[model samples]
Target: MPLPTPPPTLLRDAALFLDFDGTLVPIADRPDAITIAPGLLPLLERLQAALAGRLTLVSGRAAADVRRWIAPLEVAVAGSHGLELGTKTAPRSAALEEGLRHLRGLQAEHAGVLLEEKPLGAALHYREAPGAEDACRAAVTRVALSTGMEVQPGKMVFEIKPADGDKGTAIQTLMQRPDHAGHRPVFIGDDLTDEHGFAVVRDLGGSGILVGEERDTAATHRLRDVAEVHRWLNDACEEMS
Candidate 1:
């Protein structure tokens, strides 16, 4: 009773969507501390070409942030939990300005809580302060309600984003492009925010590949970690070649 490998045949007509962070690179103590492997850019370039420009990186980080990390590649990217795609960045709610002040207050109380400011929203990472999870979630929930945003919970993090923006809408939007149209979707991600993309791929008659240990997920396939993802992409690229 182990997870089955995804059929290589699916790559034949796939419009690939990838998640950054825990999928492309390992999660870091600080958001900016991740180390991108030297070969990652080349691998993505190869895969993007093999897929005929249908590969897109959908990430929770802002578009500029993601681009800055993977510079010179120039591939399609959906950032800010899909709130920012290409050159478009979603606007933050007016309340977020005041919300940030409140979050700053919370950060002062907890020594290790990391507060990340994005174009559309903000996130509180409590990885360094495990005991602050409940307080962080509560504070973020309050901010979300006041800002007309939604609370998005991920691994040891809580975020507030525009209520309408999500990875599902991001993938669906990209699928309408001429190069992406008619191609089945195959999204790979790890975290609660990715469930939106997972559900969308299933609805589109494609699939989702989850990275990390198994849980109740919409993704049909499980890849143990980022290394497996690299291997899978290498195999897919070779198959296409």
Candidate 2:
């Protein structure tokens, strides 16, 4: 069955929030090559001022990585999926020291695989080493189950992160701020990691827009691909300008 298209009013009334990879930037063969368009940063900058600073890029990448991708113009940036929270009002570190301590042991166990530790969480990426996927998941799951953390699955990685910090938590935190207090929230992304963020916006009387092929969408709307996301963004920027 075809899902109904969400109205433009959803974008109009909402505070626009987005995810980076697979949402704005196309997924790359190498994750490092997911670059934002040259004009995108400047367009987003204009939108921010038009929206009265209501734009945010909520991503799983580190804050520094997000900065590198979209430099010069600083929108609200939440990196490490909701782990490293940074906004004008509050700057939060990962608060995951204990989680990291445990992850190091697991990293040693899976030394050949990529174990990335970001400020908010730790991930065992198996994209490059598909042979180790099952073992990596099992190892990460063991840690999550024993340590009282939750596991988040991304494109080709398994993450064990704190139950507390998620995209929902990040959105709720943003909504509570004085500058954005009255605005509705709209989150957009594509990936299993984006579910928490979709839920956050829905619960806050906002909406979620999913990009790409649909599963059971917590998202209220959907777009075909990253290009569509860019088109919508361009439209929004024009409207705001």
Candidate 3:
């Protein structure tokens, strides 16, 4: 479905939380294959300034990885689906280590399965081998069960992390901080894992923007693709300026 027409006025007082992959940049077959847009850094910098540093990137990727990908333009990030919050590193867990080992073993067995290690978790990506999705899911599920970790499914990926953390918890924690307190939230994302974020923002009397095809979503609005997201964001910046 097409996105609703852009709003006339931007919410300068709102706190912004954006998902990186598929929302900020298009999803790549390989996690490392993604390319950031040429002017994204400047745009985010402007947006962050306008919002009083309330802009944050909330992604399933590691916070360190996110920072490296968007280097030289520092911004708050919640990585590992919120397991690693802000600049603080997640504490090492035996469950995570064991899960990683299990996933690595699966990666060796499956031709196209890739294991992405995180500070507190791991992800099994099977985008290159769609046919192996079932096997990958099963392998991750088995590991999650044995290691007492949570299984988070996203676009062609399965992540195993501690059961306590999620995007909602991350956003809520940020909202309580001095920089974000009392501000309305506006989260935009493009994956099922982001549903928790959407629900949290709405419950806080904010809004959620969904990107890509229509489905059962918690988002209040929709944008067709990454380009539309950029257009909407640019328009919002212009309006506020």
Candidate 4:
């Protein structure tokens, strides 16, 4: 199916939501292995200025981590699948601690499986151990169920997070804020975890742009890859200017 073309002058009044890893930068085997593209920070600064600070990053990474990656430029961010909102940190719980321990043990047992700890959750990455998907999923799922955490599956990763909220709730919450309120929302992301954000934007009379390959998606438009995303964003910034 063909995606609809985005309006030429959408950025002036749009609330933009971006996903981090796969959408803004290419996914790496290890999360820390990824690097931000040159000139990307300046582009985002311009975009945020163009959008009147309504631009936000919604990602599975911690907000602090995202800030660290894009140092010297601060923007609103919802991290840990919306477990942490803005600068407010997600509270740690015994369940999350226990889940992390279990995940760490699982990572130790499986070669090439990497464990990423978050403020409110943990993730098991199997990018280097493609054959261990079943085992990783099973292990995460078991721990999540036992600890009453939510299980989120993404491209080559399985995450155990709090069941309290998701990307949809994150976008919705941002929409109600003074800065984002009354603006049209446009969310762009890749991965199943982003589907919730897409649905929320569509429900709010906004649109979603899917990055990367075609799949079952709620996004109305598509960009081929990170390069295309940067191009489209640059165009939007230009339009606003």
From the highest TM-score down, the ranking of the candidates is 1, 4, 3, 2
* Better-scoring candidate (lDDT), 1 or 3: 1
Q: Give each model's whole-structure lDDT.
A: 0.90, 0.77, 0.87, 0.88
**Which scores higher on TM-score, 1 or 3?**
1
Best by lDDT: 1
For candidate 2, lDDT tens digit of each residue in 1-241?
6545556456565688889889888886456756677777777777787778888888888777788778777778888786677643232233355556666776676645667766555788777677778987886787677667778888888888778788778888888888778888999999988998999888888889888897897888888888887787777666555
For 86-175, candidate 4 gives per-residue lDDT tens digits of 566646777767777888888998899999988778899999999899999998998888888878999999998878899999999999
Query: Model 3: per-residue lDDT, tens digit, 140-225?
Result: 89888987888899999988888997998899999999978999899999999999999999899888899999888888888889
Clashing pairs in 4: none
| Pairs with backbone N, CA or C atoms under 3 Å apart (clashes), candidate 2 | none
- RMSD, one per candidate, in order: 1.3, 3.6, 1.7, 1.3
Relative to the true structure, candidate 3 has a C-alpha RMSD (angstroms) of 1.7
Ranking by lDDT: 1, 4, 3, 2
Per model, state how many residue pairs clash: 0, 0, 0, 0
Q: After superposition, how far is residue 180 of candidate 2 from its true place, in Å?
A: 1.3
- The collision pairs in model 3 are none
Model 1 ranges with Cα > 4 A deviation: none
C-alpha TM-score for every candidate:
0.96, 0.85, 0.95, 0.96
Q: For model 4, what is the alpha-carbon lDDT of residue 92?
A: 73
Winner on TM-score between 2 and 4 is 4
Q: What's the C-alpha lDDT at position 199 in model 2?
A: 91
